[model samples]
Target: MAKQFPHITDTHRDFIARQYVFFTASAAEGARVNLSPKPTNAFRVIGDNAVAYLDRTGSSNETAAHLLADGRLTIMFCAFEGAPLILRLYGQGRVLHRDTGEYKALLTDAFGEEPLGARQIVLLDVDLVQTSCGFGVPLFDYHGERHNLDRWAEAKGEEGLAAYRLEKNARSMDGLPTGLFSEEPAEADPA
Candidate 1:
């Protein structure tokens, strides 16, 4: 059986906190649906009806682009071990670029100093919370988070990261603009 709620409850919040990974799905009108598995330990429940996650630099920026074109986003959490339950947060999402005040406040309050390679913060205004029995989800043993992303980002440094984002993340695979670089200072024209 499935149960639905208007906002996240204490039980739901607790379940979210125990999860190791979450999946996000988004799409624009004419673009292919985008689904991603995020392993970063940066998801936060800001309020009963709001949640946010730190989005790291990836090969593509589909979520931000899709959210820009179409705000609907769904985040799913399923139990890999423990009581069988699957939770889905259905909502509208917005990308808060690195320069935004809201992004800064949330980062400072919940996440402390931002991690390297973090591209933006994705905030979702959750409208519906649904939970169902996850009896089919298989159990898996836990291992520590891989530090490869951190190492790669550190090796790339700030300038390298900027160039890489400009090269790969400026647009989605569907050719929709992601606005990832919208807040960056314009380069001085080399006269």
Candidate 2:
């Protein structure tokens, strides 16, 4: 069975909180589509009509680049155990890097003063919530989150990380702007 809703409710929020992983999808009008699985408690529901997720330090900035090029994005979550359900959040999304003053302040509120904690936070102003059968989704056992990424970033040091981003990030494969390096003061880290 499938159900559609106008916005996220308390029930939806509860479902969101229990998930261990979520998928983000975005694309430019005529460019490549981007979808990536995210973990590490990178997401949260800010209001009945909105959800936000931290775009942690990573290799490519496809989502951000696509959002900069096109504001549309989708976030999907599935339950692999207990019950079977697939939740899709449809909305327009915006990227707020460390350079974005307001977003940075929001991060400060969520986190703390040590601003170098995570990367950018992509806020999705959701317009619709859809739920569908996820019976096809395979059941998987819960183990633990890998600490390799965080450890690697910590070991690399800020300067090394910057060099790495410049080398790996900067633009989307389709040549769209990520606005990553555009904000000069903030170290260019494309999520």
Candidate 3:
């Protein structure tokens, strides 16, 4: 059986806090839907109807692009090591660039520190919260968070990261604008 709530409840927050990972899904008009798994350490429940996550640099910026084109977003968390439950948050989301004061303030206030490869803050205004029996989900033992991304970011440094973002993160796989940078992406490098 499944239940739906108008907003996030205390129980929902607690369940979210216990989750190790979550997934985000989004799509622009006439574009393919995008889904990505994310670490929960960067997630924060800001209010009864709002949450935000610190987004790190990735190969593509589909979520941001999709959000810009269409605000629909869904975040999902399934119990992989506990009671059988799957929670989904349906919402409108927006991106705050790293240089924005809102992003800086939220990073300091909610996350304590900026993570390596940190690119943007995605704030979601959740409208629907739903939970379903996750009987099909298998339990798995937790190991630890990976540090490879951090290491890669450190090796790239700030300048390299900027260039990389301009090259890789400025557009989605389908070439939609991600709003990562104000300027248009330079011509694709020819190899």
- Per residue, candidate 2 scores C-alpha lDDT tens digits across 69-151 of 88999999999776888999999998787777877787777645433335678899999999998999999888989888878
Superposed Cα RMSD, model 2: 5.3
TM-score of 3: 0.94
Could you arrange the candidates by lDDT from highest to lowest?
A: 3, 1, 2
State the lDDT of candidate 1 residue by residue for 72-145, as single tens digits.
99999999999999999999999999988988998998789999999999999999999999999999977889
- Weakest 10 consecutive residues of candidate 2 by summed lDDT: 110-119
Candidate 2 lDDT at 174 equals: 80
TM-score of 1: 0.94
Highest-scoring model, TM-score: 3
Q: Rank the candidates by TM-score, best first.
A: 3, 1, 2
| Model 3 poorest 10 in a row by lDDT | 178-187
Give Cα-based local distance difference scores for all models: 0.93, 0.82, 0.94
Q: What is the TM-score of each candidate against the true structure?
A: 0.94, 0.89, 0.94
lDDT against true structure, model 2: 0.82
